[model samples]
Target chain A: DVKVTQSSRYLVKRTGEKVFLECVQDMDHENMFWYRQDPGLGLRLIYFSYDVKMKEKGDIPEGYSVSREKKERFSLILESASTNQTSMYLCASSSVKGGYKEQYFGPGTRLTVT
Target chain B: SQQGEEDPQALSIQEGENATMNCSYKTSINNLQWYRQNSGRGLVHLILIRSNEREKHSGRLRVTLDTSKKSSSLLITASRAADTASYFCATFIIQGAQKLVFGQGTRLTINP
Candidate 1:
């Protein structure tokens, strides 16, 4: 079975504070993604990494950035946390073998920016 | 922007009844996938249907895709209370490098 684990299940940060959310996958997948889920917006992609030290911006990449220094780890960074940035952050990973393969997701981190 | 939109944003049904959710997309897709998320948890991959395929099933879940209308439907037969969750349909567009665009999802409730 594939396992994706997030660094924190819940987090709280003050305004303008820096925040980091980490994700690790054991399946050795080549593709990793970061997304923020809101009530009406669903899962909007923030950033994704296809390989080590490689990143791509998703639809809603503003106010957020990501890092993929190693194969198993992906980190999402918030330069200045704001109340509007509070949401359920999800991490997912998928293998690149298939054209369109299933993505395994980690238990989301509910971030509260106050 | 979201490429898919699910209909009947919320649904309620008794146990043993079937639950159906519809998703419609705006663009061509290489494949469409369905995911289930329990409250406060991440999504679980349920099923995937390619653009060339019309329907596929796994255990109690049935998925149908219509490329002409750019729509898909997921049916859960004999839904149990444990089946209660949010169902989201995501499209894998070819433009991006296997990036998935997801819909708002339909929240399902099954009463015992």
Candidate 2:
């Protein structure tokens, strides 16, 4: 079974603070992604990494950056958190071997920016 | 921007009844997939149907895809209380590399 684990289930931070969300997958998948889910807006992609040290910006990557220094670890960084950035963060990983594989998601990190 | 949109943002039905959720996407997709998320939890993949396939079934779940209409439907037969969750339809666009565009999920409630 594939397992994805997030660094935190809940977090609180003040405005202008730098926040980091971590995700690790045990399946050694090649693809990893970060997304923020909000009410009504649903899940919006923040960033994705396909290989070690290789990352690509997603639809909503303005205030976020990602790091993939290791194959199994992906990190999402908020340079300077804001009130609007308070939302549930989800991490997912998948294998790209056989076309598009099913994404396995972590429990999610609910960040509260005050 | 979201590529897929689910209809009837919320649904409620009896435990024994069947529940169906529809998703519509704006662009051509390589494949469409459905996922379920419990309250405040991460998503679990339910099923996936390619653009060339019309219908697919797994366990008590059935999924149908219509390329012409650019839509898909997920039907959970004889729904159980455990099936209560948010169902989301995600699309992998043909041109998008390993990126999935997700829809605003449909929240399902099973009345026991």
User: Going through the candidates in order, what is the number of backbone clashes in each?
Assistant: 0, 0
Q: A1-114, model 2: which lDDT tens digit per residue?
A: 999999999999999999999999999899999999999999999999889999999988999999999999999999999999999999999998988668999999999999
lDDT of 2: 0.94
Residues B9-75, model 1: lDDT tens digits: 9999999999999999988899999999999999999999999999999999999999999999999
In model 2, what is the error at residue B35, expressed in angstroms? Answer: 0.2
Candidate 1 recovers a fraction of native contacts equal to 0.88
For residues B25-83, write the lDDT of model 2, one tens digit per residue: 98888899999999999999999999899999999999999999998999999999999
Instruction: List residue ranges in candidate 1 displaced over 4 A.
Output: B96-98
